[model samples]
Target: MSETIAPALLAPATSCGVFIIATPDRLAALQQLVAASGARLLGAVTPGNAAARLADQISLDLLLFDASSLAAGEAADVAIALAGSMAGRDCRIVTLLDVASIDAVAGPMFDAGATLLCNPSPTELAAALAGALAPGGTRLHDAAREREAERLRLLNEEVARLAEVLSQLAADPANGVRDRSSGYRGEPLAEPDPDPRAVRSTIRARRLRDQHFAPELFADPAWDMLLDLYAARLEGRRVSVSSLCIAAAVPPTTALRWIGTMHDAGLFGREPDPTDKRRAHITLTDRAAAAMRGYFRAAERAGLVPA
Candidate 1:
């Protein structure tokens, strides 16, 4: 059965109009949130009736699709519907997916510009809803958003610093800076690409450290993923979205967000799988690959093993 907030009780016209496709339990959980976000609940339907329900609505401002309990094929259908319905509009789509169904729907959901949350907790879901709703949306009155912004800012700074150093190394391989003050004098040799095994070994070493110490001490998803993709590139292996998330060594939601961020930053690129239309592979961009190569060459020249 489906339900909707009555038209007479709906919020003002400025309130976002939301349509949902989810199980009864999930629908029940989101009802309060939709209303709290100042988003009028236009309609709610089960996965089986998603297409029919969507067709009846003349317009929508947001589509909240929950695929956590769905099989891969059904989830893919929902993703396709989301993309098709909002093709040229400003409708915001937020999809909830579990680990099992992520590989099937992630590619299409990303292409549709939907915010993908993998097995999100209530807090995470609320944060995502608030962000999507924006100025009119209810605020959480917490520092979580601020903290995330600070973390992302730090991440970008680190990336920029590394890129600058690698660019210099690539541009002038023979020009080695002799830091007499630190007794450091080594020029990065323009050697052949580092062996894929060497990259894999470095990844293993990072993981091994987590066994002895706090994993959070070395929690750097961006660098971890870069190394993973670099190794895959060298080995000519395709990396699925799920695989990359594992390599990130963080929560699935965080990994997905980082993947999106990296993609937007041009550090990552997506390639559609030729054999599987429902799947996509993540790869380091040419620029990112060049930086990785420079890093490895520099490491070798300085007599330090790749880490």
Candidate 2:
């Protein structure tokens, strides 16, 4: 890899410094990435070097681990050790793994308390750095939140437009309107309920069917995963990490990455199973649950569903 830093990542880092612990193969790339982000590179951690020594000695804002260079177990051990050494500090851990190893490494890394990126491009690398450096590690920036809000706004508008068209079609009986006299007429349909529970049930059913038909077709599993958690929360139910992956309607590796992202974004929380150290359950954070409720309220007020 080249030693040169990308111009796009050249923006100066915040006051908190960034560091990397990579094998020799990944050192140059990680160095360039850190330099491009305008953060100080303390040094690289090699096999012979003590990861604990460096972690304890330095004041770091972020630690980037090269998972491709290390086995999943090794990476998790290093991450967990570093996390322990840096306990009470604001340092965040980010691991970089190849696309193929993502599934095997993601859960272990997160269980060890680290965020991750899978075969990230330069742009993604920069964005990940920005997010890690941001306050609370819950968001990238105001601009990102604005973009998300805009997307939701657009979706609502589209739904409203489609609803209006359907209403028009219903009112205009000339468009394939069936005669009641031709068959046994059923009772008039009830008004659509705006209750979020109803919507959640419908979405859950659709997700189940999608899982059966084409699980990998979902373009944004993270958002869908959040919706699933929100629905589960509303129904007083708990979902395991494995179950959430199934709900995501994607491969386990892809779903794992999304779960990690959502957890980092402070939208999800994890609770270890008391009897099983290897198992954990994931749930929505209070903030995320509140946001979901607000969204449902807005949708109802917009007449997207019945009040």
Candidate 3:
């Protein structure tokens, strides 16, 4: 029912290798899908057998795990095993799950360093396979992990520097203090009045342009979601996860994954609704808000946007 499919590269090529790990009932359909993509089967195996094959140093360009047929802890275990075995390789792991089980399986799949595709149609499956088998497709996980690691390293350094500054300020109140109650350097700092309506209007215009010209040009939904949340915060409105997903304009599964990643990166926070335990509100974290403000300020200075 979900229209979101695995993103594909423009040119189609033969798949080098594909391995499917699933129960017997799921294997036939998966095999047909893989075969249709012109990929080498490499033999479909049960989860246990798949683990053995991975241990035997069998190389795979794409690994598909049927999460619907997996037991409670099986998918995670398999993912971890695959990740460990395929370390430093450009293998892409994909987990297939039913729509109803997406929320439940998503965490484990991601933790295992696998992409989640919820109930993809045959067309979607073929596209995903082709993309995974494409040249350089295997580097997707490695690139993402490296980026995240570098970001964390920088954030940690910044936190330490800020802590030292705070400690010094606490120790000596007037050491680096400046009197700015009236003015700085004898000139009053004028606060720029920003029109919230204009900001919203700019975002809406950009969204329209993107939708009309190149809706799929930007694959990363984090920035889009961040902009939406920033605008909503300015309007004194709260965003629910479902609403944010719609704002992402991607598949719900993909959008949800981005949300989780953003939350992990300290760019978003989740607050529970007092009236309903089942629903949670999403808001930009202080750091994310500061980052967005800095981005807007830079854009304004560049004359890309009206100040």
Candidate 4:
């Protein structure tokens, strides 16, 4: 991330100092101050129009005016332009000079949208900048939105590429998740189909459900009973625990106990039907979706179709 997840702590709300037409010595001092208090020392604007270039390159949090060498009019003009560039920012403009320059530089600079700090030390300067630049809700949210937008752009390109490659296969049909590289590189041409028998277990039986094997899964009455009841309740539009029992031809008390066990195992949650206060429904948790996918894959292999 360009910005830090955990933000650097700036002190409570205050204005950031403006550095207008900073000298090398002034820049070094500000950098030291920034490091000390973990505040962004904002922009170091050059004299006149040149400050805009430096500001654009560096996303600083404050500015400072060096009045030690500049005329009052010169310093004030630069401060006004800098304020114009960062018009909405809470910038503090502190003029660095001997006490004589107070009348010469400080008042005009402040009047042009800068805050005056009288002879601030490095620590005080840093604290001032941090407090001024600490993010409010809008900046953080904008940063987050930018990050997500970049991620989605990359993901979309990757998916599109995969789709293109698959389309080139299957005679370029617009359907199916085809394997483009399959049936190539000198592979064998497979044999004829065998008649169905007890050995002909569905693909579901070969799938693993946790540590347990799938063929052995339905040996538990609760497992088979749940599946049959689930399908029936869905088909019959009776989407509730009581309906599941009736659909499965099982006793309500027994079915409820099994469902309770599954729910406790993090397999589902009970939600009231949106349009019916008298009834509630169980929805599969994500783990339960995996379980259902395995079951459906098996049914597909056995050529099972909805009645």
Please provide TM-scores, in order, for all candidate models, with all chains considered together: 0.81, 0.53, 0.51, 0.31
Query: In candidate 4, how many Å is residue 305 off?
Result: 99
Residue 205, model 4, lDDT: 40
Stretches off by above 4 angstroms in model 1 are 1-14, 36-38, 136-191
Please list all clashing residue pairs in model 1, or write none if there are none.
none
lDDT of 4 by residue, 1-307 (tens): 0222222443443343334356555665555544444444445544654465655644434555665555645654554455566565554444454333433343234334444443444443444455445555423133433543464455335434533443343243334544578566543222212222211233134233324744333333244433543343334443455454443333333344345544545554566556643235655554444344434443455677411
Lowest lDDT sum, 10 consecutive residues, model 1, at 1-10
| lDDT digits (tens) for residues 59-169 of candidate 1 | 788889999988888787777777787788778889999999888888888878888999876666766776666544543354744555576677667666766777676
Q: For residues 246-265, write the lDDT of model 3, one tens digit per residue.
A: 78777766676677777777
Segments in model 3 whose C-alpha atoms lie over 4 Å from true places = 1-15, 111-113, 137-250, 256-286, 292-307
TM-score result, candidate 2: 0.53
Among residues 3 or more apart in sequence or in different chains, the pairs in candidate 2 whose N, CA or C atoms overlap within 3 Å are 9-36
Clashes of each: 0, 1, 1, 11
Better of 1 and 4 by TM-score: 1
Ten-residue stretch with the least lDDT total in model 3: 1-10
Q: How much lDDT does each candidate structure score?
A: 0.79, 0.63, 0.64, 0.44
The sequence of per-residue lDDT tens digits that candidate 2 reaches over residues 92-169 is 877777644453455556755676666666676667776676667445454644654565455445444544544544
- Decide which is better by TM-score, 2 or 3: 2
Q: In terms of lDDT, which candidate is stronger, 1 or 3?
A: 1
